[model samples]
Target: MEKEIKKVNDEISVAAFDPEENSFKSFAEKGFKSVINLQTDEEEQNVSPEKEEALAKDNDLEYRHIGVSEDKLSEALVDNFRQELENLPKPIVVHCKSGKRSGALVMMHIGCDKDMSGEEVIKQAEDMGFECDVPELEQFLKKYVNEH
Candidate 1:
């Protein structure tokens, strides 16, 4: 997991992939308060979201799921994610398949929230090693950050 705290409001950690069973306990032990999963159910990985949620709860961590896929990455989805972020406990760990999606979303949120430009968002994403290789996300980020 990659840890970074923003002055804006949240302490977010982006995971390289879906959290494993042991990872949940580790997160709890490490003082992470919440889990925000950005994967859709259709993209099956190591563990199911339901099981992941159970594991998080068992570890006494808040768990929230927002299914973001190629077709699902939109301003509305990001808005919903922001709303969830507002209500979720701080020091949140967000994850997707390769961490790219999670990073992109978080950076986009920062960009829009702070009124940063699309270029700035893209540059920061590159600096943070986030890849918006997926055409859909690339296009959406370019459009959304500039528009909002």
Candidate 2:
């Protein structure tokens, strides 16, 4: 399937596959400075992290692999993801197998950083063409808001 890039906001976008060479060039030309991959290396049909990273670097885009698996999703991971999102240069592209994890992580970052409610975050994600409905992820987000 051809990967689609859905812009989440002015500074961030989400997609599935790692951009190929031409795609990377287009992103660079369009001013995207970095990419964050949320899929684990072992995921079926995933692009090799090493190859994708090399291509991104060759095209002058900073590449970060965060590798979040379904079973390992947690508040700490969300925190680190947010830190990376804040630390990385924008505009950034975050991607997973189907953009689900990427979108969820972005939602968590927005919920925590902007103090948005879970419903608000879900609505925002849906508006961006990403459905955020992972129960574990949602629970973690709720607990995080309650704690902090």
Q: How much does each candidate deviate from the true structure in C-alpha RMSD?
A: 2.9, 2.2
Candidate 2, residues 1-148: lDDT per residue as tens digits?
6558888778788875555556667767778899888878787643577877887888899989888987987778878888889999999989887788888888777776788877777777778777666777767656665555
Candidate 1 structure quality by residue, lDDT tens digits, 7-118: 2234777876766787888889878899889889998778889999999999999999999988867789988887877788888888887888888888887888789988
State each model's CA lDDT, in order. Answer: 0.81, 0.78
For residue 147, model 2's alpha carbon misses the true position, in angstroms, by 3.6
Measured by TM-score, the strongest candidate is 1
Best by lDDT: 1
Residue 109 of candidate 2: its Cα lDDT?
A: 76
Where model 2 places Cα greater than 4 Å from the true spot, the runs are: 16-22
How far residue 131's Cα lies from its native spot in candidate 1, in Å, is 1.6
Reference-based TM-score of each model: 0.89, 0.86
